[model samples]
Target: MVKPKDPSENPTTTTNNNKMFIGIVWNCVPELKLLLSALLFFCSLITLFQFFPSHLSFSIQDLRQCSPFPPPSSPPPLQIQHPQLQTDNNNNNNIIQQNGVIKRNFNTYGSAAYNFILMSAYRGGLNTFAVIGLSSKPLHVFGKPTYLCEWVPDSTGNGSGSVTVSGTKILPDWGYGRVYTVVVINCTFPSPVGIDGSHGGRLVLHASTSGGGDANFNLTDTIDVLEEKNGLLNSASNELAEFNKPPKYDYLYCGSPLYGNLSPQRVREWIAYHVKMFGERSHFVIYDAGGVHSEVMEVLRPWVERGYVTVQDIREQERFDGYYHNQFLVVNDCLHRYRFMTKWMFFFDVDEFIFVPKKSTIKSVMDSLEEFTQFTIEQRTISNKLCYLDDHPGKIYRKWGIEKLVYRDMMKGIRRDRKYAIQPRNVFATGVHMSENTIGKTTHKTEGKIMYYHYHGTISERREPCRQFVNTTEMKVGGKPYVVDTTMREAAGAVKRFELRMIGSALLKTRQ
Candidate 1:
């Protein structure tokens, strides 16, 4: 049988025949031409579909993956909703169509539409400006989002403020599982500024991602606009004021806010240890975050009276939840409190110590940074090196020495130090282990030059069941082998002396 002729065998003939047939069809009746055109369009669509698949299903998994917080155990995950699409005045169509079905525009700005987590707000130096923190990035209509903040004066008869819609700027926060966009809004009022310089009032945030559409999203609760009281608010003013004037103290170590009913003895030890180490070169700002023993207060009073320490009650400050969260607040307050007076400040906890291996003092170690001509060092962090102390329950009064220091048996993982020193007026917000934001400057992470030792098992009363240990790794300070032991011993000595004097005074009072 004769083999069937294949079209692929004659490339030139086949192309000519196909073109002639298409030309005939093009000149044929209009209905046939239309039918041919429709078939071609369908074929083209199939080819396109092979290359690009349509994304119809919506899932918040994309946003959740970028969240800084871990996935919650209980509450169900954010349900995927088909977002409404609407066209705006701007030539760009904002319609989000899925599978040939067009849904109505869904405005996220509606108070009931989307969840808004207002973290914090700080009014700018100027009467017209304010910076606010949003829990997550606002959903906008293809263009840059605009934020409008409405300031309503306190019932104390402070007048209302006007809202001039200004452009919005977003800062992605991957650390908190939410994008905390810092929005700057311009607010004006006919009368004098109603927001108190000390006591701030509430404001509503009107956020819109659409092009001049109705701003339906509003964050109402806890929309506090903190007054710009710190001189650091204006960077230029800070630079000018601090240039010639000498600071009163070289550095200030603001101790951690005490809470959770920590052992008074341990607290006393922590305070005294910092005092003995950094007191000469640095002033201390210590705060009682409530639940402090009277005995501990008595031990700290002498230092306070001498002006070496500034004692503050946590109750004096605004209230907040979470242990470390409140601690950050106290640190921020201390930064503002001593911004201009001191050249530098270290936000430190009692359990952690910045161990200067070669230098005697933290200030001296900081001074060494001048040698690094590459960058102007504004802040420095001693790498967190966990050094667990062997449980010595019997030797409560006995001194902490090299033998008691278990350098070999240390925590296995790397502990990044949260404690840091900064030029007081330069940093904006500080976190537990580091500053969230600072002026345009560099940080000197002294991983090798300095060591940060965190003594976790200090309180003899509290014990961990599975205390892991690493090999003996000695951390020497000032060329001394027993540096931690000596410093801890001094802390113990301070506690012991205070206890003895308290007893003696009681006896003397009874005799009298």
Candidate 2:
């Protein structure tokens, strides 16, 4: 470092004394500049290579063994179903094979299981619906298209269209223990939704497709295929399971008066069916319209002669008309006549019926109920809005009258279609509305033990000209004339035509 550079060797200044600023052109400066340029060029190459790695396969030439990238994990399994669906058309009702009728029990599966069910399957092409919860009643349903046709057979055979999916869906109740119910929903495709496939027809549910249209059932939602009706009668069944259930009911009861067009044949069979249930103790109480005619009594004599019922002819003594209070009259008279035996009296129109608990017999159950209940009243309010029927007064059929008169003033409020529905609307009664009235006495019996089946009274005596006893029904609004009479010339003329039907039978019976 101490060695003094020769003036020519050091490229910065020339050694020409006063002329040092004017240096000679030398290879030394050229060589020095060339070295600096070479160093800068190498640095730029390194940076350029780092920035453009894609263009440069840059073998570090130093690092040769780097691991190849790990192979990708296998694709996850496709979620095939919400849960699995197993079906069987053997045993009884066509059963969907069940593995999870209920979700796993909590205490058994853990503890805290609430009452609920899971409706998983909607309308996926092939995926079955899964339900995961407790069912309050035994109504456990899942949406699956059932053939709803002939029974399917097994490899071994010996079965019908019955059997729920095997396995258990744990349904835990708050107080009750866990229960498992297998629902083998029966669905027949090409179902007719509206009546007879007519115009403006809607999605009418078929008995085959909609769980027998049972009653009071919960469905998932629209896009949903599950349909169930609530509170179905232990009605007709083809299966043996329902048939084998112990008979707890004693008998069924019915009371009516015959009218034109409604053949006594149907009534006769209806009574016989009821009597079959109770046998020897069967009773039929009937009162026919003797007003303006005594012919009905003579015609129904065979039914009375059988001693299965007692017949009363109110018209025999007086030229009476079926007044406004005729319906109430029947109840009062019957209750008074059978007051001693009638611990509980159910008062309803001819179209109305009393539905009792399945577990108890009619006589025993009714007797066991507290004796103090004087009267139980059931009522339903109908709406002006029509349901099921699009055309209000069309040819399809009429229930109460020829046409339902909608009062624009009264439409906003609740009104009774008294003649047809005890109520005016579908939503009003909440499905066959009813009341239980114990005439001024402590009803110690179970509160909801009894139910009323109040069908709109448009059949039998009320609709036909031959059965109408009262000719007039009078009503005055604001002291204005508002009287409707069935005895007018038009009505009387119609009655005259229908009476001819009975006259032939009447003459024959009298001669016999």
> Number of the top candidate by TM-score?
1
lDDT of 2 by residue, 1-512 (tens): 69877777665554454354335435368877998897666555544444344534444221222312232345755674544434343322222345534433212133221123222211101112222212323233332212222212232322232222222222222122223221212222232221111111111111122231233332322222232222121223322232245322222122333333342322332333333324454455665543213443444454456555576654331222222313223332333233333223233344333434456555654565434433233333211222223243353233222122111121224433321111110100001112222123433234355533322433343232122221224433344332332111122233333434323333232210
Off by over 4 Å in 1: 1-174, 177-215, 219-244, 291-293, 315-323, 370-418, 440-448, 457-512
Best by lDDT: 1
User: TM-score for model 1?
Assistant: 0.48
The weakest ten consecutive residues by lDDT in model 1 span 374-383
List TM-score per model, in order: 0.48, 0.27
lDDT of 1 by residue, 1-512 (tens): 99987767888888999999999877786988788787666555443443333362133445344444444455555787755655674434345576756544443433322323343454332344334343233333223455555655555543445333442443322233222222223344332343343333455566654432344433333344443332332334322334347888877877667644454445554555566556555688877766444655665666676577777776532232223434544565565556667876776566565556543556667776533311221222221232344555555224332123334222334444445667755655555556646665555556665555555535323322123322334554434342223433334555456545533333111100
Q: Which lDDT values do the candidates have, in the order given?
A: 0.48, 0.31
